[model samples]
Target: MADFIGPRLYACYNCRNRVALHDDIVSKHFVAGHRRRAFLFSHVMNLVVGPKMDRRFITGLYTVADVECSDCGEVLGWRYEKVHEESQKYKESKTVLEKFKIVKDNW
Candidate 1:
């Protein structure tokens, strides 16, 4: 018989609430505020997107909303609601979860 495995997940560091999936990771090489490491995820679940605000990043200006854990309300990262630069449009609707804020689950 063959063994079965489940989809790998990333959980909130504080409450252990499942937030993202390993397969959904778009890029591991990302940086958040204050030089903190981050990961770009193509999809995330159990998260609440906060208000949209304009912020300027190294790439360009974008409209983003803070994403929080739906269970515990912990701020995990931000989601790109709108991208101003055409070159950065691919990042729209994506979420960036801080590395330190998430822990591996179902590994």
Candidate 2:
């Protein structure tokens, strides 16, 4: 994970819409797409602008906010947000691994 440290560029694999996550975020980041309970709580995930969210399924295990590419409107991934669950407070965004790529030491 040391290789992940430094200036990183997070881009949507669909249209290559990119966002920068600096060293600080890199040092304390989480794998957004992991299925484990611990993986869903990471807060260092990058947020890209211009991408829109669709909550077609809002009443389920988790309130899903489907995210898309800002330019081409491709399916990037979904953000699992905690809704109506007072015991568990969780909100995390995940970009599809096949639909997104991270380039470390970008600068």
**Candidate number achieving the greatest TM-score relative to the actual structure:** 1
Report the poorest 10 consecutive residues by lDDT, candidate 1: 1-10
| Candidate 2 per-residue lDDT over residues 1-107, each given as its tens digit | 36654455555554556633443231232334443111222332444333244443223355555545455666444555444455433343432222234333355
Q: 24-84, model 1: which lDDT tens digit per residue?
A: 9999998999999999999999999999999999999999999999999999999999999
- Model 2 stretches with alpha carbons more than 4 Å out: 1-6, 19-60, 84-88, 92-107
Q: For candidate 1, what is the lDDT?
A: 0.97
Predictions in order: lDDT: 0.97, 0.41
Which ranges of candidate 1 are over 4 A from the true structure? 1-3
Error of 2 at 15 (Å): 1.9
Model 1 scores a TM of: 0.96
Q: At residue 42, what lDDT does model 1 achieve?
A: 100
